[model samples]
Target: MGWLSTIIVGFIVGVLAKLLHPGNDKLGFIMTTLLGIAGAALAGFVGEALGWYAVGEAAGWIASTVFAIIILAVYTRVIRKR
Candidate 1:
């Protein structure tokens, strides 16, 4: 159930994150999902560090999306090195 929830929430986060970011990301659906999942993890860490939320607490769509965008940006930069 945890993984399932992550994917579902991640998808929603990915969409919102993409919307939040300016300019097109040119990412496919699968990449978007990956980004969302990664974003959730990133957000979770940051949120925990900043005391925004509990370690296992769920991140709302907006927060998740913003985090996803940041993750996607970093991922893109790393991938471009290849």
Candidate 2:
């Protein structure tokens, strides 16, 4: 469930994140989805660890999307630096 949810949530979040945060992100489909997956997982674990969410509950959509945007920004920065 976790892995499948990650992929599904990743796709949804990826589209939303990209639309909300249009910048110098030269990401393709896979990379964008990867970004979303990373963001979703990050938010889920962090929110859980921070007590923002319960253990079994997935991160909220808004949280996932926002984190995805943050991840995208960080990604672009790293790419730019490299």
Candidate 3:
């Protein structure tokens, strides 16, 4: 996908992640988008390493969501402590 498409998908994924995760994260638009992009990147890397996806392949929604949730958890932990 193109960069624009990726950004759009990342935004959607981020929104979903925020919704799926319990509690209010208080993240703004840019942070949420970055969170989603980071989650997608994490899922893609792990999937590729495990041979579940080929190079340049995008991660599926489930994997992206799962990764996003994990990221959100970490973000909450680290940010809330500050």
Please, what is the whole-model Cα lDDT of each candidate in the order they appear?
Answer: 0.78, 0.83, 0.85
Model 3 worst lDDT window (10 residues): 53-62
Best by TM-score: 3
Could you give candidate 2's per-residue lDDT for residues 1-82 as a string of tens digits?
9788778879889889999996768788888889888878788878877888775554467778899999998888888998
Query: lDDT tens string, model 3, 1-82?
Result: 6898878878888999999999989999998998888888888888878878665545566677789999999999998899
Ranking by lDDT: 3, 2, 1
Per-residue lDDT for 1-82 in model 1, tens only? 9889988878878887777777666888888888898888777777878888775555545566788888877776777788
Candidate 1 regions with alpha-carbon error over 4 angstroms:
55-60, 75-82
Residue pairs with colliding backbones in model 1 are: none
- Give me the candidate number with maximum lDDT: 3
TM-score of 2: 0.81
Residue 64, model 3, lDDT: 79
Residue 18 lDDT in candidate 2: 94
